[model samples]
Target: MIVHTAEVVRYVTAPAVTFEPLRDGASRGLLDHYLATLAVATGPVGLTRMIASTADMTARLLDFAPDALRRIGADAIIADSAEPSGPIIAQHLGVPYVISVTGLPLLEEENVPPPFVGWRYRSDRLGRFRNRGGYRVSHFLMRPIASTLHRRRLTWGIKDADQPLAYVAQCPRILDYDRQNLPPNFHYGSPWRNSPAPLLDPPNGDKPLIFCSLGSLQGARKKLFAIMAKACAEIGARAVIGHGGGLTPEEEASLPGNPLVRAFWPQETLLRLCSAAVLHGGFNTVLDALAAKVPIVAVPIAFEQPGTAARLAHFRVARVISPQRLSVATLVKALEEVVHDPTYRDMASRLSVAMEAGGGASGAAVIVDAALSKLP
Candidate 1:
């Protein structure tokens, strides 16, 4: 039987890991949930970067003891296939590794340019231009640093791990990026299709409905939650929100007593029902919105998020707002434009058709099967 396993390899510490840090029980719980899914399909194995225990020890062992990987009996190692920790371990195990690009591919060497540069590169012409230059420089310097950290903590030796054979991106083919340069084996795995059914029935109201979310990871911040709340208030449209990682209990409790606000609306359901959305421009949210044919207003926070927001603006599928300038007025204006303007909705709907045509579960399954084929 072919054994399949996932390891965490990228952004396990600085950003992705920090949100819930698998080291902390919160992140670990999420990891466990996904691992359980994989376990049902393939079998479970430990995913590290859990709470950021000095991965140094784990790396050293994998670098030296190829047998450790063998002991796991995994035929293929999928990195970020579950989380971002697998590819590093797979690299040292001298086994085949597949990098999973669940979010917009942000790493340059990986050829996955940050999603939505069309917007990010233009937000503030001068400031963004300078920031882009700095980001490039920073990325150059940090590649090795990131690589070193991966080597030291995930493998027996940094020098021993081989770069992965392919990556499975979560984006749909409609949002096909220009930067992913890996082998043809690199694949895109869409989670929207993989997700459960829409959380609620499409809104039946005649007035335009607006849905708001910050994706799942960054939904915990009170300030951002407040911004979303205020935006919904100003729009005066029917609204649904999935707090994701953005709201506090108190904040949720305090939501204005308007039918417009909800703490946990199924995003896909709401997107399908809403006339427009105001979101953080996360890859998942953007793709899901596009698939649902809903126009968007993106307020990006960090990393590839800004780029993703920028792309929606460039495509005219959504309005892109800088986090610094995302005032209630701007949101109200953008919301009105998307809701009232036929052009925006038309563009979004056409893109939604394209996104729908781009296969989802089948694509991921194809990749998974191919990875298995390479195994002994």
Candidate 2:
């Protein structure tokens, strides 16, 4: 299977950095961004139109590629989400394709709305209930129509009928993923997060270190930063925050203290030397901390975070404090608990061992390659 992956990419600075849009306000024109980025990858031209979902966009793709489709031939395309147009093109080209759900809820589950909805908007019991209805609607109505369109057009002369699989989840078996009555073909690949950056070995620098970040989606708000600054100061921990979300000039200038506060740090790299992490509880951050064997003081901003926090509590690995109801006192206390309490550290250590047991990238790569091998 020659796989083609369709996912969103954004460069707040330059040169185009590709990241999952699991956070809020990260991508304004997602479809446009994906269509542009997809062309950058090597693939067939006619199929690229199907990937872009624009017959016109195919022309632009074709101009760059003289007889690209004829040269590449038919290969399997694995789309990360229904959001991407690869399936549409795959159908038109009669080529095999797969859908890869990058996040938890988007993974092969019945009756769950997009997790991105949670970060962008408020969710409740009623909202969740409504999502169930909407899930049913899309699963029954929209999915079939789109799937039919894809199959009819592109898959006409496709050699392998069963080559294109349904859902490929990027979940590690080490984590507590809900694996119920999933089909044999419904696969869980290795975590892409396993490509952890090389640890910088930040010299442990003499103070109790706390890794702090509100997440890239939720940028550095002065109020939140101020509160965190005060809390970290009280707790006597050096703070390091990431600037992935693109802070403004004033925001950059206004960060509390220089020697103690860092503007940016590689997440996995920092996790190794830090005593504790104070993050907005994005799934990636949470999983990275678990992989690094570090305790977390999760201040969930929205959506799956609350559920993620609940899951952490269930796992007995970390503590959850809602940013909405959280105070400097509560933040300070949570930090103290994670930093001082042996239990939190022990649980984190245990979970970390479990996470590492999967063997990171190599482990995940095996599952993905197996699925692809079965395709043709």
Candidate 3:
């Protein structure tokens, strides 16, 4: 996204788990493992895993940072919010740190549903109560890791440190959400890449095209793809399945008709040509489809996917199918509904305009620069 910019620190490797230079569907397993674990998004086990993963990731990055510091004589640290350790590291170095988030900025708010629950946004008292309880549970799960981080901070020469967002009050937050949707504090910048992405050849077919993938994490669902392929066929649609290493060679060979199974494909290129999409409800994929003005059939299998699907469903841009009820018939029905209805596409188009105005990655850079300029 900083392709047009003159000053982006190109770090090929920062986190121990990195995804590939994505073409279409390569499965970088470590990246997928981190993401897939969060697919659950809620629950005691899920929260514990997320805490552990982020803490480990933070430590790894810290080990890598001294080299980065020496190489650049670094000025400031900007971190993805999920990691939470970035700000602390910067604190140890006596440098300002900014947080960048690629999702809703509300975090755990009483008025909104806790993320990934697929609950509608409501101001009702009951909704607030539900959110409060959920947030408390998550905080409880975080205590162990929080305590560990607390000790780590002392070792890092940060004698007094708070949790990640505590720094945000004093730093800029470049958020990947719309101004209309986000609270006032976050600077809304779209996560979609502003630079033009190269395209791939569309699947060869006269039928309405459907793009399908579960993304990298939680993508090893061969059964889901099989159902999607079958449903696409039943609906007289052609699906190009960017399996992301999800399907077997035999499974790919046995796909009924016009279902193109590949390791991956240029997703943006396909989205531009697709009539519909069947996706795992990953936030990035959803934003990509929205930017392309494609309607979606969101089957949320894990993590914040259900919440992402809920947001789309709330916008009337998608039809959400819970995994428990996923079937060829239901999937087919959703495809037909979206492809035939102009409303879904129109809603998606509207979101595209709003998100496009959100300044994408370049906008994010501008925010980061502004944050640095004010640093004392």
Each prediction's whole-model lDDT (CA): 0.59, 0.58, 0.69
lDDT of 3 by residue, 145-236 (tens): 67666777777777765433221321112212122344344565565453545764545657888999888655667788889989999988
Candidate 2, position 222, lDDT: 56
Whole-model lDDT, candidate 3? 0.69
Scored by lDDT, the top model is 3
lDDT of 1 by residue, 1-376 (tens): 2222123333233331221112211332443454333222211112122212223323333343344446556566656532334665665455677676777664543233334243333334564455566557545533533564564554355554456766667765556545435456666555535454655446565655677786565566556556666666666665566775355566776765143444566666667767788887777778778878888888876546666776677667888877688777777788888878888889888877766655575776576677768767
Better of 1 and 3 by TM-score: 3
Candidate 1: which stretches are off by over 4 Å? 1-71, 81-85, 107-136, 140-147, 150-163, 176-182, 188-192, 198-206, 245-250, 257-263, 374-376
Query: Could you tell me how far off, in angstroms, the CA of residue 26 lies in candidate 2 after the best superposition?
Result: 18
> Per-residue lDDT of 188-260 in model 2, one digit per residue for the tens?
5434653556656464557776777766656545567666766877877766766554566667657664424
Off by over 4 Å in 3: 1-51, 62-71, 156-185
Prediction 3 TM-score vs. true: 0.81
RMSD for each of the candidates = 8.8, 9.1, 6.5
